[model samples]
Target: MAATLPQDIKLHTKSRTLELIYSDQEQFELTAEYLRVHSPSAEVRGHGIGNGVLQTGKQLVGIKGLEPAGNYALKIIFDDGHDSGLYTWEYLYDLCQEQENYWNRYLKALADAGETRHGNMIAKG
Candidate 1:
């Protein structure tokens, strides 16, 4: 029994969420916007550590396509024309597990950059 393979995967387009059930019966609901902004692609995640791009204006981005990449990952195509990320099963699991910490960091980064999740800039004092 491997935790690397998803037992079931459902894409709820209307809600913009990806539901995953693992082999161990663990379940996770990952949002499209979360997947989009935190894409494993270098464009979003960066090719090196601490070089990730701060994605904004993706509050409404949708998942256009989901194609399997061998038995390791899935190739996600976003509605905004981003198709570079190869989201492996392990990566997805990590996203689900560390979602809270990661999201918090993202929000803090946005606020520090004076930008909102919608890409709007905030006025500084």
Candidate 2:
């Protein structure tokens, strides 16, 4: 089967979310914190099985910028200085489909590891 492509991509920095539209009329809005921690980079995913890193403290992270990685994926730069992940159309779709499950798992892992989301948002003081 052939892969589906995204018809449009919009990064709303103010809302810190990525909006993707596909030719099939499917749309998704993903948050920057979710994308950052779930990045498929070696830094997070590692080079082999069981090498994935546990990311913490990204509750308030925001997208700094986004670049197209050829015609297949998006290169997202997070405000926390992470810019290695390539978000492909298929992957993004999967994320949208399983967002709730993934988020629950992330939260559980953080709790099990005695960690917390150290978001980048500053307190209005």
Candidate 3:
């Protein structure tokens, strides 16, 4: 079977979510934080296997824009100055399908590392 591509894409800046609509009436809403932490870029994914870096403090990340990469993928420009990862159609679809599982795993990893999604915040009085 061929890979499923979205029929329409909506970037909701206010909500910081990317909505993918399919012809079958299916839709998936992915947050910027989720996409940022799961980026396929070498910076996030690492140079090779088992060296991936954990993205922290991305709870407030937002999508700046989306650019199509040829006919196979999307180049997502994030508000945090990250623009390296190319989210292929297949990968995006997989993310949509396994969002819950992936999110749970990410949360678990963060907990294991004693990290917080809020990253390092400096309180001002």
Clashing pairs counted in every model: 0, 1, 0
The worst-scoring run of ten residues by lDDT in candidate 3 lies at 116-125
lDDT of 2 by residue, 8-94 (tens): 788998888998777555788889888888998999999999999999878778888889899778899888778988988678778
TM per model?
0.88, 0.86, 0.92
| Candidate 1 lDDT by residue in tens digits, 1-125 | 26667789888878878988885558888888899889999998787998888998787777877999998899988777889999988888899889999899888988899877674433211
Q: TM-score of the candidate numbered 1? A: 0.88
Candidate 3 regions exceeding 4 Å error are: 1-3, 120-125
By summed lDDT, the worst window of 10 consecutive residues in model 2 runs over 116-125
What Cα-based lDDT does every candidate model obtain?
0.84, 0.83, 0.90
Query: How accurate locally is residue 36 in candidate 3, as Cα lDDT from 0 to 100?
Result: 94
Clashes of 1: 0
What RMSD does model 2 have? 2.7
Which candidate, 1 or 2, has the higher TM-score?
1
